[model samples]
Target: MTETETAAQSSIWTDEPFDVHAEDPFDRGSFVATVVRRIQVATADDPSTVFGLVGPWGSGKTSILDRVRSGLGDGWQIADFTPWSSGDAASMSLEFVNTVADLLGEKAAGEHRAKLAGYAGFIAPLLGAIPIVGSGAQGTAEHLLDAIGSRPPWHKQFADLSQAIQTLGKRVLIVVDDVDRLGGSELLTLLRVVRLLGRFRGVHYLIAYDQDTVEDLLRSTGSVGRSAAFMEKIVQYPFETPPLPRAAVIRLLNGVLEELLAKTDSHLDHLGLQRATSLVDALAPQLRTPRALGRFREHLNAFADHVSTARLDLLDYVAITWLRLNAHGVWSQLDSWRHELRSGERATSLTETEKLTADIWEGRIAEAHPQADRTGTLDVLSFLFEGVDVRERRTFIKHPRAMNDPTYFERYLLLAIPEDDVDDELIRIVAAELDPDKFREAATALARVLDGNDDALANLAISRLTVFRENYTTPNLLLLQFLAERMHVRVDEAERVGSPRNGLRPLVAREMALAVLAGETSAPDIIEMFGETEALNAVWMAPRFAEFRDRRSDLAEGFARFWADRLRSEPGAYIKGGRLGGVAELVTFALEPEETNGLLDPAVTDYDSYIDLAEGFVYAAEWVGSSYTYELQFRKDAFRSLISASTLERYRPQVLEHSGKVEYDVEGHPSRDIPPEIVKAFTVDSLSAL
Candidate 1:
């Protein structure tokens, strides 16, 4: 359906005060059938044990009790528990015994009830005026029982009555639900009451337990065995309470989503209805059975409670959960990245300084959670606010810095924008809908994420951000810092970008080689330099680090050089494997450029032999070249990549082919036909000696 057309239907799923137990003709049949059938078989012969309907918290257990009570009319007796929100199982036990007496006592032939009722009348009012004065309550019970039973002792009267009822063979059944709600001692006492009731052969007790809930009651009183014994004898074995039949669960869930959808004038068709029902039905078992459905649904209701005039289908509930989580996860990834940056990075030169790359998941990106997508709000993070790149050296990311911050009121402007609007103008407009502070804070927060997590996360964010930028360069300020701080190493301008450091041009040569290899756009002035746009894009989109890592070797060298210059300030890098014995190297390498204002300014007679040493490392690995060379393979790789294949075809020859054998054909692309082993060598040959 068209958005407008669908919105017009106005589903009731989004509505408030969802009728927790409104049985409908189409949906109630299955759930009610399961419940009724259980009750029928148990009580069919005579009054069997009250149908033990057991389940976990939020399983809509109370709703089932209400529905069964309503469905059966007067047939079944339900004496539910009301343990205080903080009440323990022990306290609830007294209520259990009293409830049993009240349900079964009145039907007893004789003055038993009148006596009990008289005691109840006086004691209840007194307790009403006072506290703990019920007929069977601990303090007032003994006092009132003697007065009402008219016996010297109250226990004698109760035991006599109990024995008389046992001899008569009258079977009485009472159901105690919400047992799982009580914790600690109160729960044990409730269970104790059931076992005590087991003393009378004709009396039966049905109790409910939440499968997912851990009963503090059993452990506290240390009477779980007693409760188990009662279950084994008085209660039936394997009291399996299956899930709420799918249709009924759907109906109840639909009731939950009612108000929000109702405002939009949405009525669910059969297809919509089926989809909505199945959304809950299928997911209820996965998150942890139907027992926790209410808690799960409660989260949905709380999130969507403010959403008015929205289409509240079953998926709507999932959407709200999904959106909240994605928004939070993006925030977390950004936060983690921010915490990992260098001290200086925080002051200026934000990490990524590029466009935002926050991931806005549109569906359940993790485990099976239908509610995660219920509200259709998953892509909310994809929106953007004001942004601009200032001073090629220092990037400033912010929500439009107006005197009063005009962007604060942008959402209202969006109403004027077309619904089909997907560009920055539209995004800026919708952003106005959100609180300006929220948008600004979230946006700024997203940018710092690039610098987040120091170098490690910077690399990952750079790679991911690169891919995102490729799709759309206009992405707002999000996760920029995460990509920036780690991936882009800021080289201090004080470092020499000139010719020859000592006899070693390896440093400047490599930098020159990288600058040359990247196009003219990559030329770093005596100021800040980020990674190549192409390289950054490749890093973001490529699935494997190898694919992105393949291009990053040159960029990494530049970054390393920049830092090497900075380290000269204290010159503090841990020394390893050298004649200097890991001494800090303060000297900066320089090389003459042959060209000016180019990717690299290379000059002539600047040949620096690859230092033949024990070893030189690249990233996480070391390369062992010919004649015990300590040269990094990246320099030659870049120079060769930039030079025409014919320039060094012999020395940097096509020694091997892509097929891994010898490439006898010198006519092919120089690197294309080279074998793996042949690909490693760097030739000293001159292509104009280039």
Candidate 2:
């Protein structure tokens, strides 16, 4: 009823050929004019001329014939013959003769119509007398000759028709299309009939076919090198279809893309127009014809409707879709590459099979797209598989930039990983869990269905927790914590969530504790599962918890006390096992507004312990000064308390000297610089107090 509804109902890509008389979208009118002129010139010189229009399948041969017929106007009588639709050679011959007679009879009146019917009668008996038609062919031919009483043979009758056509001052143009679609026997029979019946003086023939295929068919009759000679004898003038222009093809493709985007409910802004332009440029050389562009649209229509919700990179999705349609072997190899990249062994180090598969895929690309730039095409492959080394053999490693980007990683999984790897039911369960409104319901439903008997589902749910971590929305984080809690409950009941030998309880528990600490979802529940020490340990290792700690000091202090107790019980372990690094990180999280200055007394273990405490205090001071500023005076007082007058005198010169150096060779050391102003503040504050 509405304009939008009407537009949506129209298809973006139709499988049918374009209408012959429609406006030319590809600027093909110039070529059509040239072809029409050539046909007219040849037919004017000799009315019996046969013109052959040669082109590949789906290369607009039929459209060209229609244009040529239209260009000829009322000067000639045109009989359009579709030989392929006739089913058999005999039927095709009959259709051709009957169509011409009808056209001619319609043009002529009274006496001329009677003359044309007389010629048609003479040809009918001869056509029936052909051996392929039926039995009693010789008797029927003899009887027809006797009845006519010395009437000329069928060829003589056709000559009379040609003479009658000339006398009537009319030229007949017979257009035959898709001759290559016929079988070998049917093709030979049709050619023979055309050579015989199409030789009238005032009649011209325009036949269309793929020359290479017809030549092959002729060669199969043992003609070998003489097939070209046979074609020359049949056709007076031959024209090969020219290559469609690249710019024209791209313009047509863009039109199709715009239509598809308009019809679908997708976030089109995410499909970067610049990247799509680059991809279209890359694909232009391979899409040599209009039909190739149509096929690409068909494949895109099938796969790209869900791209907005799937959150796939539009460039990567288009590249993969192109490969799936054009180069199937390369697509299969890329799927395998995705599988290996997800595997633990290949993630850490490349395997022999992965190396071989990459090489095979490169070779296939070269073979399939010889005209395309190999390096540029492989760049698309590199986008999908980060570790692919298209140039060198031994230096294959994942690109660090792509490995760290979450968007690129998500696209790789969405496109490369097969649906069967994670069953549809499991994927549905995961998707439902990720929804904000459905989070609680999906979690409860999964807990009921997979409490004890479904370890596989539980493990799948656990494995996908990392996927949700990248989506740092509040609702998504809450759902991540909820799913982790459900899995922990299952593990607590002694259910086999993972392999018995590996025991998934510890891994799931660690993830669950980290989720609570980073999400600040259920701190007490986290402490119950991993106990106080292990819970604090897991939180210490998790990244991006500054916001969580800033808002929840009560939870932060509980973890900090657990860390302090561990340091007190095993002071020697803190020095020997390099645990001071962990202590430094924990102190930063535990620093609060109320009691920040008093927390450092627990760090006094020994004389050397004072240096570690001062480092931890300086790190925490820098963190608070840069990140947290709610109570600035209290944080400054906390920094002065950790370093007394004597301790400041002891460490100030060492800290300043280390900071002055341009570079240091120490490995796994802190690289953050403590501002000299903070150290000077500590000394001046102590002097002021004195």
What tens-digit string does per-residue lDDT give for candidate 1 at 62-114?
A: 54555555555554444544443323222333344455456554565344554
lDDT minimum window of 10 residues, candidate 2: 395-404
Off by over 4 Å in 1: 1-21, 24-35, 38-51, 73-110, 113-173, 197-203, 212-216, 224-230, 244-334, 337-690
Global fold similarity of model 1 (TM-score): 0.37
Cα lDDT tens digits, model 2, 1-690, are: 223223322566664666665665556788878878876664422658888889887787877788888898787878887767654434555566566666656555444444444454455455545545343323333243335334456666676667666664667788888889876545665676677655777678889999989988777655235888888988888878777888877776666566556645533453356545655666777676667766787777666654544544455566677766666655555544555433312433464433434555556567766644555556455544545544543221232213214334444445433322232233344434555565565556545544545555445544454444434433335444554555455444532226321233443334444455455556556667544444555564443344444445544555666555655566455545544445535555576434334345455544445444443333222224434322111133444543344655554555554443343222222324434454334433332332
The candidate that wins on TM-score is: 2
Per-prediction RMSD in angstroms?
Answer: 19.5, 12.9
Which ten contiguous residues of candidate 1 have the minimum total lDDT?
579-588
**Number of backbone collisions per candidate, in order?**
83, 0
The lDDT, on a scale of 0 to 1, for candidate 2 is 0.55
